[model samples]
Target chain A: MTTPTPSSPSGPSRLDPEPTPRRDFLGLASLWAAASTMLFAAIGMMRLPKAAVLSSPSKKYLVQLPDSLAPGEAFEPPGRAVVLFRDEDGVYAMSKVCTHLGCLIKKNGDGFDCPCHGSRFGIDGSVVKGPAPQPLAWHKVTRVGEAYMVDEGVAVPTGAKEQA
Target chain B: MSDSPIKTSQSALGRFWRNLAGAPRAVWRAAFRSGAPTTDRTRSQFVFNNIFLHIHAVRTHRWSLRWTTTMGLGIAAAAAFLITVVTGILLMFYYKPYPEAAYDSVKDIHFVVPTGRFIRNLHRWAANVMVVTVILHMARAFYTAAYRRPREFNWLIGLGLFAVTLGLSFTGYLLPWDQLAYWAITIGANIAQSPREVTDALGITAYFDPGGFQRQLLLGSDVVGEEALIRFYLLHVMILPLALSTLLAVHIWRVRKDGGLTRPADADRRLGPPPGDVYPVFTDAPMKTYHLAAVVRGRSPAVGKGPENTVPSMPHLFYAELAALMVTVLVCLALAITWHAPLKEIANPDVPENPAKAPWYFLGLQELVSYSAFMGGVGLPAIVLLGLGLIPFLDREQEGTGEWFGGPGGKGLVARSAIFGLAVVLLVETVAIGFGWIREWYPEAPQLLITLLNPGTLIAAAYALYSMWLVHRYDSVRSGAMGLFTCFLCGFIVLTIIGTYFRGPNWTFYWSMADWPKH
Candidate 1:
């Protein structure tokens, strides 16, 4: 549908096929030849590394009991960003993040409180105060050995009794 | 059947490949619609047919091919994006944006998971490199005046892409959930409260109270929590990247449609008449040529578009792309091998870092915020971005572009602007620090005056006014604008370096980073 205009350099007014030397064809052909050679070389070099470098291991973590933690106390995993409760009932792992704005709540008397604002949650992770839209999340705690593995992806309601 | 001696050897393997490629003819038809193109016509056709090559023009000007012309920064940025996408997806496999698991997942990646740390390093480093390279691309375009005339809208789009690039990086900053990520983002979120500072300073703001708007907009609440995390995570992983990719396609397409990059101003004298056949035909005839004439600022459409000086996109552009990508990947790999991405303790809001800082990109703003939050964080950056966007409209002179600093004293101008800018910024900073000392000594100065009346803002305003006076003195708005831009860039560089390394406990100055105690 489109054509080059005569005023432009690409139109019918500009084609001087007679002026192009035959040797120009050789140069043009050799350009492709050189490109293909480089292409093969690059592919050959990249292939081995591409094949060898990839290995994806699964990300499931198995929690083991450390010497510092015991059965009757609440411990926040220094790295895990979760608060674990180990009492007579069961071992519970709750998300330390305030459900309202996401700031980690500090442990207060019989409850937790947001330091940024003042959203409060009970010891079992239920919302005891306003501004916190919801309760702190309870997670799935599975028993691997003597210790418990807490899966933070799973969420549960407050006061639900679950054993690891 | 047994083959002949020649056919029985490597020719047999060759024949097999030939048969495989040629089989049933339909397989070949289904695959390479433009097959084994060797000639110029067929090469152009091949490029036209291929989806990848469709983004590129069939031919490119010789100047555009020169490494110095672009310094390969844009191409390298694109290559870095490719690396980011690959590595980001891999990182996402182990990453969860949730609060409890996020920090732990980072630790696992660092210590336990196979190649998780490696991929994270690649993603982090490549993302950083991409931001830098994109900025360099903007600078290259600006210095070369590639955003003039027909390319004005493209410049705006490029700015949009720059914003998205920063957004991508900023959102990604919080993914690791370590102390560094937490505090850095906290500082960034805090800086978002800048608009309110001005509003609060004015008594009228007490009733209207738009101060919390920016922070709430960024964080969805008073603080950074789940909503912030999820929002940042989605923006980082999906929305911003998608937007960047879409805009990048359009930006490149416009470059090709607008008749490639603007060559050097005097290039017409060097390039004479181009062969007619080598000129790219548009989808229409006389109308298209007229449009091209309008777009190209017509001398002749093909004046500099000769075949001898140009090359086809098929091999030349592809080769350049491949080379850039290889170099980028190797560099990224080297960086990943050498330096580990920093991950501190998990997020603990109760015990904050002594001098908590924003990420390095925004550290310049943070440095400014220490003097005056609203002006430094919000007003200054807005002015720079808007001013940059308005350059094409503002500087209408036709001849003085496609070269460094836009004049005969280009390099000299750059050096002078740099020195002037640095001296002003440094002097202002030292004085501001000195004022902090004065406040400590007096203990009677109003905090409000200290907050808003710092010498930093005063010096910056004075510098801007002086630059405008230069515009009047030189009778050139373009020259004036260049001076300011160079000044701002130099100031930004100095501020970032200072903020990243010098400040210590209680936000006090340290002579060297090594002198700071390792908490």
Candidate 2:
């Protein structure tokens, strides 16, 4: 056994400093792994919602149309243009939207008047007033047996015949 | 030698079978670097050679493995952390960190992705479990006196790990971007903002304010917005986990250096004598005398105590941990599959969640803030932490190191302290009701000073004074510390329960949880 010298510090003792620092390579490697992961995540985040798929809007509307538009009668569906006109042959569908500015037209004497831009249309959607450039566009109406199925996506000319 | 064709073919097939079964012996030796431990020498070598098993000691104390000693809280915490990391990584694939898209992306995750909801729920619940079990781990360490002497530094590291665990939870709370997530984080951020309250009350914030410093540092703007979202995401994903992993490595290493846990004095004697070759004697002198003379740090030779009352980490601890991991993962998965995580309407800043809670844990602090911001947010929390940090330094008695509440008389002392602690907590809570006259006298005083002179702080100081007297009376600060720690825990639990259930809109008091509105 070696006796301790007060002045000498060297030893074959188990009093040497730890191997703890030597194991720090594990920690450093873990951190580097974390840094690289963050970089990859950053790169991933750079790719935006560019490939997001938006669903297209449906083009069909189910509208109930009675046999005829008698006097003081109308078909004003909520959120849809009201179609009201009394014809000798049958009931004719007229758009309540003014062609002048696309504002909803209210019922008037023998026709409709635009609340927004002061444009008027005859009962058959013919322009009977100024500031109205063309007649109201017609939504092609198809008879689905009992009620009318309007092709709202396809708007046709007013005087043209409505499809069955 | 006229051999039949069928017999000759069978001989060739036998050769193929022998080669298939016997091949890769060289490769297996190269990979393992050792044969299976049929002997003691090989068992030690097998453990030391493997990268994964090297962290665990070849042999461990029976007490350390016993259910009551640790209750497997620390292992559970570690296992929960593993779950969080795995589930969190999977979640990162689906989560987008933008205000407008964050909520929708989460919605898409719920409605579109398969098993995505389960992953997210498991991540959340695992985080909560991690936090709770970590606190329980700390309590176990304290009660067992594992933080005594050489293990004190490890205590500080453990404290850091606890804080980081909470930080992990806080950062994750904001990711979902629902009204609940938004306002919950807002309440937390607003709590962070309370540092300015003291500074502003003092009128010196123009020069420097650390509270405002933390606020601006965290939030790029006045409120929780795009920058806050990104910062929280980065912290949750990378910065905190990296810190936790490093600290955990150090903590485990230090545990070995500190002489495995501070088990009972005769734990090794109970296991009979140490095995001869397994744990070869390392030093000529006593470890105690050597350590005092010269601070030497390395792996303790006491690790290989013997296998009678100890077992190999290879199969024993590893299998136990695996069982814990399996149970935790299954429970979290079951919870995830059965109940979905909360995702209220797309975070509309226009519509606020009234009486917006700051998660259940922080609701205690929030409730305190209702009484006083400085005391609740900063002062009281500081006191609790300082008290905990000062424990080892204050209680210098090592006589009762490995026992609960300190020594043989611990049960009696703790029971007395528990009674004292509960009474103190009750007195602090209800003192204001009795002291209505003080409020009447100070009707026109500044609210800050009114909060400064709150009854909770005074009653607590009085309790400390009384406990200090008892410490002198019994000649033991350990008893005092026990009383204070137990009191703080009771107060925290009570306040959290009250804040979570009984507190209503506008911070009004209600009789029970049912009294609160359905919303």
Candidate 3:
């Protein structure tokens, strides 16, 4: 217990001029504990959305290329995110998902055109026109027996092809 | 137990009749804790004691009850919301929140369940009505300058409620899982992902994109599917409603604390004293002590500003509220009966709707998005909302506080602003649609340049410059705010109308839907 002094005219209280050192330490400790608790809780919440197991279909699928498909033609598998192209060199896969906003692009006469925004990708997946910053991504392709397996989850370098 | 000694004079039958005669009064007293309110004291007590009526002030200004004052828009909006809640609950009992079954469930509700169709229609119409009424209510508050002084926080709360209302509507729009719902939500989701435009242009989207995160969180996946349906349903049925109700409680409480609905500061002087004034003693005090709920360090201006020209809220204000509510319900009922809510073909992602549009309210935003994805959808709306939030603080002039268009000179200013705003919006839209923009002439233009120089940005810039000129000319912040707000409001209306009616396939301009080429 301290008596009121000339310097501290209002009251002889621990909080008058400033909190006592012990009180300040305790307050700081409590604040840190509360903040860390909130941070951990937020981190815990972030883990919930990334499920270990997904019920949806896998992104990697094997596509049987139509025998009649010409060397320079593009064949898009129904309901899949990848479009397969077989040329004289080999079979390659390009992502149907637009580089701009992820709208699946439709195959035009010479290239691909995005329906959402008017971004156009050429036959080789290079951006002919854009709001699309980069060209369409190329997906990893491997020959699984006669059918080609395109892995949408893995991006391969542009023009990388599975040898025919 | 036998009653014999005290009832010697009365027969058994007479005693029973006497007991029955007093039963009604006993029940009434038990329920109300008071007699019928024939006097001002009882009426005040009736309002103060009742839980349902307690949100209202015990005494309401007579001016507040006028048809022109608030136009009962707030009450109507609340009533419409109530209707939506009741009907929405009924809908939840039968409606499934799964992607596979949602459309089927809606179809069953339409064709099978007892009065489900009517309830669903009512819910749809009521939600629409709530949106319209809420917007009109906001417009009313703005035009009358009711968002001034102590009521600014309440205005912000009201704005929050407005946002929650739209959130509720947008979430509900997806529950049907039809083509209309699917495509509309897709367009909306894309708009939510508009920040990718900026990120993409800057070549940082691969590492960082808040817009993409928002869209993913909203949809619960990359697209509107099983996860999106459940997420939207949860938000629509539970989270948003909870938020809205809580905000509404605060909004109404703030209204009470702000000393009821605002009127001109000199309203009492103009109207003289109210007729049949019984509380002369309460009103006549030079320094009303009842208002001093707390001790003050200085001379407070609120010392003598007691309530004026007021009537008991029980019969006067409550009656008006009830009337407004009834009118709203009747109108909704009429609309529900006359027109059925639309249900389109089941959602097909592969075969997309050619001119896929968002809900009517978001059409204005969608129209903007057609010009430039990021600026139109994200930037412009953000700026508008920020501007709206800052208005009360910026225009601190409290002179024409509670009058329509801020009184005489204000009316002329607003009119001029509206016309100017309309002209600017139309001109910009026409030029953008007819002649094309920067992207058309400079095909190789940078995405950032095109994004920054779209029709939406042009209109916004024009409006800003015009409002600043008005401010400089009038030498008043309030007038400037008024001009800007009116211009934006006009632009919003014009854009919405065009988006809803004039635009067609591929978002191309059309005079009418009749002119749209058949697929």
Candidate 4:
């Protein structure tokens, strides 16, 4: 084996390196700045919200019902839109959108039937059969003195027991 | 049968013209000098006859069949990539990136566009094939120690390419924007984003954060919408493709630079010179080293004659590669034509999907996630990927000279041990992941262990421990590390494959209630 000469300067090893050059530092900073600027611009364009269109002008209120509808009595409005059902407690409004594919469900006997995918929902907005994963969401019903009010914003969860 | 020199020249020119269809003078010169020129070599010569070819052409002993197999796998992957690109472009003509138009465009493709179904099928099948080929390529590389020194950087780049490949697959998954694609990508992106947590009495944040960067760079906003779709589209079609292509070029170039595939005799030949001076004095080494080593080992050196074993690219490997490429393309086309890509109902962002499944490649990890909040959430897969990326630096043994088992050139007990150990670890992990899924589907007796400790969490913990032990053992005892690492790698492969095959519909999460709340 050859012995090392103490006086001689060692050659640069493969592992060791030096600090970044001024030019490289400047170049990297400029590149980063450019990339960030482009990213911010793109994001700004994407987040620019467009004006919402009013599709159904005729239907102002989702559903308008009498002070009370008796039990087992159902109200199917025009356009096969929202269905209003009454029980001893209050009036419940459920949209026709099927849980499976958003197909409008029609009243078949006691429950609603989805024409597109054959999903079935009971009178209480509970799923009965077919491909629907859960019961239909029930809108909140308010007993305004004697009359009832349906709030579309307060959509109730389809409880686990309601699933087919 | 010896002909006069003039007659030979005439015959050569005639054959050249017939083969090349009116060859130019440059082609003639190259053919004469190189014996027979391949398309790649011909193109190389045409471009610039410098050191580039030296950096591009793959060199290996003919009998080191694994290298050829690897190249075959890579070509298969490249073919799949091409298919995906072509089909993706075709789909792009009909697809709209916006949410409102995305589902409608898909409907149009299925109903209105001519051969749209075929295009969709091609894209799907090609994506699947790309995933398979990449995995196979990595496996072959590991087995052959192709990731060893000088090629270490290339190995890291290979890992990057693997990541990009998966990214392309995952991102493209959402473009259809159907129920399956939407929920699948959502779950996948969620898993991709799941925080990396370390377990204690209370959970601690891991050093690295998962999905944080992905959220910023990929999603941009909180959810998958127009922004996500556009970003994924650009990445799938342009950014990833360019990056992968550039990296692939560099990878191949490095493979050539590192003197191609290592031969069994290379170890013995390298033993003659000291480790430091082995490269430059390589040609001066005694030929006896190769002959004697091969004879003693009961194996013949694949390359004939001395160390200067070189083969012409044409009519041999090039033909094989071309044949492979053609076969790949034909198979992809056939699949594309036969099967229609799945497109379920339109994606309604307000609705929740049930049992949301990630892409197939990530199923193994997803399956793990279902078992425990901790293991599937953060621990094992992260460590594995990070470890894989760091493999090149860990295994610093010089490729050509290292022995199998001991010292400089022997295939000793250490390598064998490593292989077997890795195989065991893989087997255990497979059983663990599988059992975890089964337990989830059918609960075992309500016991403390069953309730508190999920199989996924246990398996992940075991895997993590094994990986840590592997690194430690390898460092402490040089001989056994190879065997252990091999075992670790094999375990992952078995787990992934078995997990993929067994999970059935769960692999793609076809259940309608993907995101529905389960009591």
TM-score of each candidate structure, all chains considered together: 0.69, 0.67, 0.87, 0.58
Model 2 residue B491 lDDT?
66
Q: In CAPRI terms, where does candidate 4 land?
A: incorrect
B32-56, model 2: which lDDT tens digit per residue?
8778875655776788898766777
Worst ten in a row by lDDT for model 4 chain B: B196-205
C-alpha RMSD over true interface residues, each candidate = 13.7, 24.2, 3.5, 11.7
Per-residue lDDT over B375-417 for candidate 1, one digit per residue giving the tens place of the 0 to 100 score = 6666677877998899888877765667656643466666777
Each model's lDDT = 0.71, 0.68, 0.83, 0.58
TM-score of the B chain in each candidate versus the native B chain: 0.86, 0.85, 0.92, 0.67
Proportion of the native interface contacts kept in model 2: 0.00
Clashing pairs in 3: none
**Candidate 3 DockQ score?**
0.22
For residues A1-164, could you state the per-residue lDDT of candidate 1 as single tens digits?
Answer: 34454565565454333455679888989999999999999999755322232122222345665656666457875656578876657777888865433456668778876543344678887765423434588887877778777777676666554564
Lowest summed lDDT over 10 consecutive residues: which window, candidate 1 chain A? A50-59
Q: Between the candidate structures 1 and 4, which one is better when assessed by lDDT?
A: 1
**DockQ each:** 0.02, 0.01, 0.22, 0.05
lDDT of 4 by residue, B387-471 (tens): 7777667666643322223322125444554565555545555555444333334333222233245554454455455545645
Best model per lDDT? 3
